[model samples]
Target: LQVGCPGFGYAEDMPSALQNAARTSYARKLVDEATQATIEEWQKQNGKLALHKAVEDDKWKRDATKVGLLIDAERDALTRTDVGFRLPVHLAARGHASVEVVALLLEFYPDGAEEKTWHGYLPVHLAARGQASEEVVALLLECFPEGAKAMCKDGNLPIHLAAMYEASAEVVALLYEACPDAMAKLDAGQAEYVEKKRKQGAAGAQAARESVRALLDKLEARETRDRRIEPETLPQTEEETSETVAEAA
Candidate 1:
C-alpha cells in the first residue's frame, strides 16, 4: 500500500517491459495485431515499410540476422511494391546486398527475382550494373537466367552494362554464359567497352578488359566448338543456355 509513492502512478500507465528473464530468444510472432495493422496502413500510404529500408541501409544490408528479423516482422513486405513499383528484393540486388541477405529475400519471395522495375531493370540487371559480388550475381542468374537475355530501358543486357562498368570477370562471365546466342553480344560488349574506356583516357581499363577476356577464353573456345559441331542447335532453351555454359565451364 505505497499510496505516498509518486512514481507508482506513472509506472502503472507506462507500458510494461518485456519479461525475458528465462527466455533467451523471442518467438517469430513478435508484432502484435494492432502494430501489424498500423504497419500495413503505413505501407498502403507509402508503398513501403521498414523491411524495404532494411535491405537498402548499409548497416543492415549485409546483416542477414537483422534482415531475417525484419522478414519475420512482416513477411508480406516481400511482395509489397513501393511507389517506384520496386520490391525489397529489387532494392537488395541494386544495393549490393550480401549473399546471405539475398538468399533470405529470395526465400520469402522466390518470384521477386523475376520482377522488373518501371524502367525494366530486373534484379540481375541491377546486380550486374552495381558490380555486386560474384556469389550474389551467380544467385540472381541461377534464380532467373532469363535476365541475361532481358534488355533494360537502355537497350543493354546485364552483360552489356556489366562490361561497360567493368564488373568483376566472374560476374561478367556469369551474365555472358546465361544469355543464349551470346557470342555476338560478348564480343561486341568487350570491344566497345574497351574502346569507350580508351577514349576516356583510362589506359588501365584496356588491361582490365583483357583480364576479363582471359578468363572467358575457355567459354569462347567451347562456343566455337559447339557451333562447328552442332550448328543446327543454334537456339537453345533458357535452361539449356545457362546449364550448357555451366557444364562447359
Candidate 2:
C-alpha cells in the first residue's frame, strides 16, 4: 500500500541485479533457519557435526536407525571435508563406523571413497590402517573398487597400511586381491614399515606383521600349487608332448 516509500526506490531507480536480490528470500529464510550446527559451520571447522559427535559419544554403536535419521537430517554434510586433512568418509572408515554406517554413507556419497586425505590416503587405506572389520572394508571397496590400488604419498598401498595393524590379515588379503602387484613390494617395504612401528612401541606391531607374513605365505603356497597344476590343464605343445613321450619310454 505504501507507494514509493522514502526508503524504497522508484521502479526506474532499481537495477535488475538489485531487483532480483530484493525479490529473493535469502535473508529472511537464513535468519529463520539459522542454527549453530549448520553443515557449513561443521565443514569449516573439522568436517564433523552433531551426527559425528553423537556417533563417537555412542562408542561406535551400530544403530542403523539413528544413523539413518541423522544422515537424513544432515544430508548436506555427507561430503564435507575437514579444513585440510580428512573427510567424513575417512573418519567413518577408520574403525569408527559400523558396516551399516559404511554402507549408508556409500549409498549416499559413493564418490567419497575416491576422496583422499592430505596424506593421499583413500578411505580404504584408512579402513585398512584402522584394522576395521572385513565388512566395512568390503563396503568401501565396493564403492571404489580401485581404491586398493591407490598408493599413498609414501608409496604405501592399502595392504601396506593394513600390515601395520594386528587383526587386519583379512583386510590385507582383500587389498591383495584387488592389486596383486602390490604384494611383490610387500616384503621389502611392508616389513620396514612394521618394524618402524614396532620400534616405536606400537601395540601389536609385531603380531600384525606376523599375521601379514602368514597370509603372504599362504598366498605363495597357493600360487605354487596352482602353477604345478597349470601344465596339466593346458593343451601340451608338440615339443612338450614329444619330450613327455620320450621321458615316459
Candidate 3:
C-alpha cells in the first residue's frame, strides 16, 4: 500500500529518486539501529563489546569455535574501533586471537590490516611488537606489505619493532623481506634494543645489541643472496614482448 516504497509499485506511480530515497532511508534506519544496539552492548560490558573481548589476551580459556560464533553473531562489530582507533584486527594481532580468528577478521575487513592505531601502528607493527606467531605475522604482512614500511609515532617500522621486541628470526625476516630498505635501519633498531635492555639491566645490554645485530646481519645476508639469485623480475617491456611474439611466429 506504500505507493512510494523502494522497488515497489508501477513505474508511473513511483519516481526513481523517490524510490532511491526510500531505500536509502530504510538502509539508514537499519544502520542506526545496529549502531545503537552495539553502543548499548558496549556500555553493558563496561565500554567493550563481545567482539572486542573475543580477541583480547585471555589466558584462562581459548576457543576458536566460540570466537567464530561470536563473530558470526555480529559481523558489523568487526569494523568497530575502540578508544585507540584499534579495530578487532588490531586486537587480534596484539592478543591471543587464533590465526583463524585473525583471518576471519580480515575476511570481514580486508583494509583492516592497513588501519593504524592512534600511534600509527599498523596490525603488522602490533603483531611484531606482541611477538605474535610467525603465521599471524605473515598473514598480517601479506594483507598489506606497505605496513612493513609504516612508522609508528615512535618512528619504529614493523621490522624495527620486531627486532626491538626480540621477535623470532623468521618473523623479523618476513618484515625484512617485505621492505628491503628495512635492513639499512638495523643500526637504529640496535640502538633501541640496547637502550631498552640497558634500562632493564646492565647485564645483557651489550649482548642485546649483539643479538639484534646478529639477526639483522644474518637476515640481510640471506636477503642479499636471494636478490642476487633472482636479480630482478620486472614485467617485460613492449619491445621484449614484441621480440617474444616474433620468435613464436
lDDT on C-alpha atoms for all candidate structures: 0.64, 0.58, 0.62
Q: Which residue ranges in model 2 land beyond 4 Å of their true spot? A: 1-48, 55-57, 189-249
Which regions in candidate 1 have their CA more than 4 angstroms from the true location?
A: 1-47, 186-189, 192-249
Which is better, 2 or 3, measured by TM-score? 3
Candidate 1 lDDT, tens digit per residue, 1-249? 012211112222321222211111243355466654654554465444777877887877997766776675566888888878889988998898886687667754667778889888988888878888767776676556677799878787887778767977666656655663644755665756634433453333344334433433433343233224244534577998899899999
Clash total of candidate 2: 0
Over the stretch 166-247, how does candidate 2's per-residue lDDT look in tens digits? 5354565566656767757777667555444334533333343344344434433533432343335556789999999999
Best by lDDT: 1
Ranking by TM-score: 1, 3, 2
Lowest-lDDT window of 10 residues in candidate 2?
Answer: 1-10
**What are the per-residue Cα lDDT tens digits for candidate 3 across 34-151?**
6546534644674436677668747311555445445545667777888888988898898856766776566545778888899998898898889886667766765566788889
Q: Which has the greatest TM-score?
A: 1
